[model samples]
Target: MSEPSAGDPGALAARLAALPDEQLLAVLVVATAGRDTLAPLYEAATRLLSETGQSGTAPGVIPGTDMPPGYGPSADLGSSSQVDSGIGAVVGDPAATGGTVGGYTAGGVPTFGSLRDKVERRIGTAFGARQLDRQTPAGRGTEEQWEAREQAARERLAQIRTSLHEGEGS
Candidate 1:
């Protein structure tokens, strides 16, 4: 079957729920770590759901007046401004450390370098790919090699898919 669109919250939630414990934990860590970057993604997901009139419905269910779990209107939910400000407070302010209060430092700039070496590292031993180190000559060579190989593999895979389609048509 074709992949589900990212805008589908039900699909996304299903995918998240289907993940193995380790993978789910990894996703949670990544999500929590990149909460700042993911603000847009969250907004997009919510917007898409609202537009589809499925914001309050359960996954795979049609929209109606009754709100689903965690979907009910709250005092905070009354305004996008509140949500935006809350997200800004959580992400924009470097002092808003996880599970901690009153902890803003001068060196608290949340650069990718710091996040990679500090946040992600503390969350897990490794990540999907080496990003920062990939800038070095040697690292860049390795990354380029991997990318070239990956592109070749994708081309072959696409060709196979086309061939399969043609065979089915015949």
Candidate 2:
């Protein structure tokens, strides 16, 4: 077959089909990184791995084992058992050891709550004290009151101009 251009869909499909199962899995893993809405792609990769008798576990890990890495049936528990006992003691006595209880501090301060509640409380306190009248337009007075204020400002300006003129004549 002739070499096809990079933009050719047929060529791309052929090249992808020619890749081994491991390479295709790697490609799918890279494509799905930081992306959440690619369930079909994830399923395809899993199907390909299963078809090839490969597992999703790390290399050298037995597939059906429930133990974590570096831990097995014959794993040692020498000095670490003492450390584990100490942690157990601390976890058992929360109040005596000053540990947190139900996500609260030892001093009774709340350490867990939704941020939405706090935001709603702040907004309520800010807008609760002043009850707004829906019938009145905001930042505006009555027409007669506005006219009176404008007239008063005009008289003040006229008085200032008169004083400046009198000072100039003297």
Candidate 3:
């Protein structure tokens, strides 16, 4: 289905709902963290680096929206000003995305990075919870490395869940 314009609240809601579960989970992660929360984003981004390609646009000229200019009563869904567009731009490297969100390029396998670092970043974010981009180690490794990293992400997830639960109890 065509995405609704930013001005169309009803349609917008539908689009949000239609987004795939991964994207929805990412959105929920952001919402739970509060857009203003830096730690969570960095922690999430770190985990994402291990589990998924960085969010980004296509390498070539971005394919235009299916609709022609001025085609509908509602404004073009992709033409709205940045602020009007509720979501931030995707930020994946063309090579990593194979020019799209689908997956990595041919022969390009995904890998995981520092579990120690992931844990540190997640825990750091938990403690600092309000700050952004504190300490996330960067580099490369195979899926084996990801075992620890994924574990760290899971642990961080637990911490976040606990914090939320504690806040609710109050």
Candidate 4:
């Protein structure tokens, strides 16, 4: 019979079936390495291997040997039923994690803090705040004006904190 086209699934299956166990295993390894784009090849190799009763054993492994449970190819990794079915119940999910679908939290609202924030806050308190205070223009103003500005800043900070800690402790 003439060789079949590369895109022909039937021809591919027939060719794979004709391969010896070792060559078929090599094909399987190569197919597995390119799994994202070679799923069909991988499946064909796996099917051929299984048909020949050489499903899971890799090179150097003796066929029909007593292998430990779960170490064999027949072992179950996980079933779909074992997965969390709740909506937005996955890590980095926007709905569950309170972030945008693009994986970014809203501006000025910290989704989480790290050691960097603590270190920066400490440094700011120690020196940066004093430098900023000195550089800030001190215009003549009433006590009420100063209090209003301070209160506004405090409110803004509180709002940001509240946004960051929305679902905590519940």
Model 2: lDDT of residue 163: 98
Best of the candidates, TM-score: 2
- Residue ranges of candidate 2 with Cα displaced over 4 Å: 1-3, 43-170
- Please report the TM-score between candidate 3 and the true structure: 0.21
lDDT of 4 by residue, 1-170 (tens): 87788999998999889977766664564445333576566546545655665533332334334544433343332323543333122212223333211112322132222223456569879797666655656532444578899999999999989988996857
Per-residue lDDT over 16-127 for candidate 3, one digit per residue giving the tens place of the 0 to 100 score = 7998655554554333332345646634543553355334211122222232232212222231353323211121332222222212221223212112335667988777
Sorted by TM-score (best first), the order is 2, 1, 4, 3
> lDDT for each of the candidates?
0.43, 0.46, 0.41, 0.48
List model 1 lDDT by residue over 104-165, tens digit each. Answer: 11222333322333564555544434555676799999989999999999999999999999
Candidate 2 lDDT, 66-120, residue by residue in tens: 4443222222222234243322222112232233222222333433221333566
Off by over 4 Å in 3: 1-5, 22-35, 38-42, 53-170
Q: Count the backbone clashes (under 3 Å) in each candidate.
A: 0, 0, 7, 0
Query: Predicted candidate 3: what Cα RMSD to the true structure?
Result: 26.2
For model 2, the run of ten residues with the poorest summed lDDT:
87-96
| TM-score, model 1 to reference | 0.25
Worst 10 residues of 3 by lDDT: 98-107
Please give the distance, in angstroms, between residue 56's alpha carbon in candidate 2 and its true position after superposition: 6.6
Candidates by lDDT, descending order = 4, 2, 1, 3
Q: Whole-model lDDT for model 1 versus the true structure?
A: 0.43
